[model samples]
Target: MQLIFDTLTGNTRRFAHKVADLTGVEVVALADADPRAPYLLLTYTFGSGAVPESTAAFLGQHSHWLRGVVSSGSYHWGESFGRAGDVISAQYRVPYVARVNKSGNAEDVRRVADWLQTHAANAAD
Candidate 1:
């Protein structure tokens, strides 16, 4: 799995590191990802519910192989509607998991990792 993000305050990056630690996935800045690998965009939401400008630009540049986007922080009303990148997954998909926090704890990340593992295993069967 490839984790991509454009972090300004490092909060998003800090959570990405936790994801890497749990899943052993490579964490890459949006500019450093391999275009061929499946991608998960990690971005922060602004008050207007827009993805960081840098992240939006990165996504525009590499619109290929973008499996899903995971936005950190609350979104403004009508902020995240209709933004699609192949497939979209969010906290709403799995309510059992907790949202990512600045403390570097992400139940959702672990849930995603486990879900991916199960999906891969099922595919092999």
Candidate 2:
């Protein structure tokens, strides 16, 4: 599976690259992705739990190959923190892989890496 991502403050991008480094999965920006291959989306949540308009637009046209989602946000948002993952996961019928705090800690990377490793074969199909 590909690692597709969108970022504003670069936290999501950093996280995506870290995961890619561990798993050797290809990583691409939302604008650059082909979306013909299965991918896990990594993105940042915008205002009050809203999905970035770019992400929503990308999904609008090419959600068919989406396999899962991960989102980045501060914990301060409480219920709204990383809610983009929830929204995308529900709308696309894919797993909500993770919610990372900012760029995420090493443990967070490890957990997401493990999940990606576990699901790699499934996404290939």
Candidate 3:
């Protein structure tokens, strides 16, 4: 699957690039993505479980191609951490594929990579 990221502090972008490298998939910024191509969104949460406005805006016109979402956020938010991902998943009817803290760890990458393998294979069918 294609990867697209919406980043503010670069964490999401870095994570997306890492995933792209691991999966050998192409990645683009949300602003630069092809609206018609299917992709899994990588983004970070905003205040109190809010989706980033940039991601929301991009979804406004291109959500037809959105397949899943991965999110990054601070753990300090407790139960609210990564909650924006929940919102997006529910709103878009896509899977909430992964959640990471800050830039993510090796385990996070593994989890996402594993998911991509299975998810993509399922899609191909």
Candidate 4:
């Protein structure tokens, strides 16, 4: 799977890169991501549970190939934490793979990697 990320503070990018390293998935920026290929989107949620404009626009154009979504947000947001993942997952009918705080930890990477690997193995069959 490919890792497509959109970030302003680089937290999402860092998490995406970690997941890419763990899963051996190729990571790319939202703009550089291939729309024709299936990928997992890693993005940051901003104020009021809103997705970044860039990520939304990318999804607007390329969501057909979207496989899943992972969102990064501050835990301080409470109920709003990572809500963008929910919206995007519902919007595209893709899995909400994970909600990571800030840059995420090793366990976050492992969780996402495991989820992707499960689907990857299933797809191969």
Q: Score every model by TM-score.
A: 0.67, 0.96, 0.93, 0.94
Better of 1 and 2 by lDDT: 2
Which ten residues in a row are the worst by lDDT in model 2? 116-125
**Model 4: per-residue Cα lDDT at residue 72:** 98
Q: Rank the candidates by TM-score, best first.
A: 2, 4, 3, 1
Best by TM-score: 2
Instruction: Compute the lDDT of residue 18 as modeled in candidate 1.
Output: 74
Where is the poorest 10-residue window by lDDT in model 1? 85-94
> Model 4: how large is the Cα RMSD against the reference?
1.6
Candidate 4 positional error at 5, Å: 0.4
Model 1, residue 109: C-alpha shift (Å): 2.9
Tens digits of lDDT, candidate 1, 1-125 = 47676676787787777777877767898767656766566766554545566776776677565555655553233534323221223422312222343323456677657754544433322
lDDT of each: 0.56, 0.91, 0.87, 0.89
> Candidate 2 residues 1-125, lDDT tens each?
89999998899999999998888989999989888778889999999999999999999998989888999999999999999999999998998888899999898889889888888878756
Clashing pairs in 3: none
TM-score of 3: 0.93
Candidate 3, residue 68: CA error in Å? 0.6
What TM-score would you give candidate 4 relative to the actual structure? 0.94
Clashing pairs in 4: none
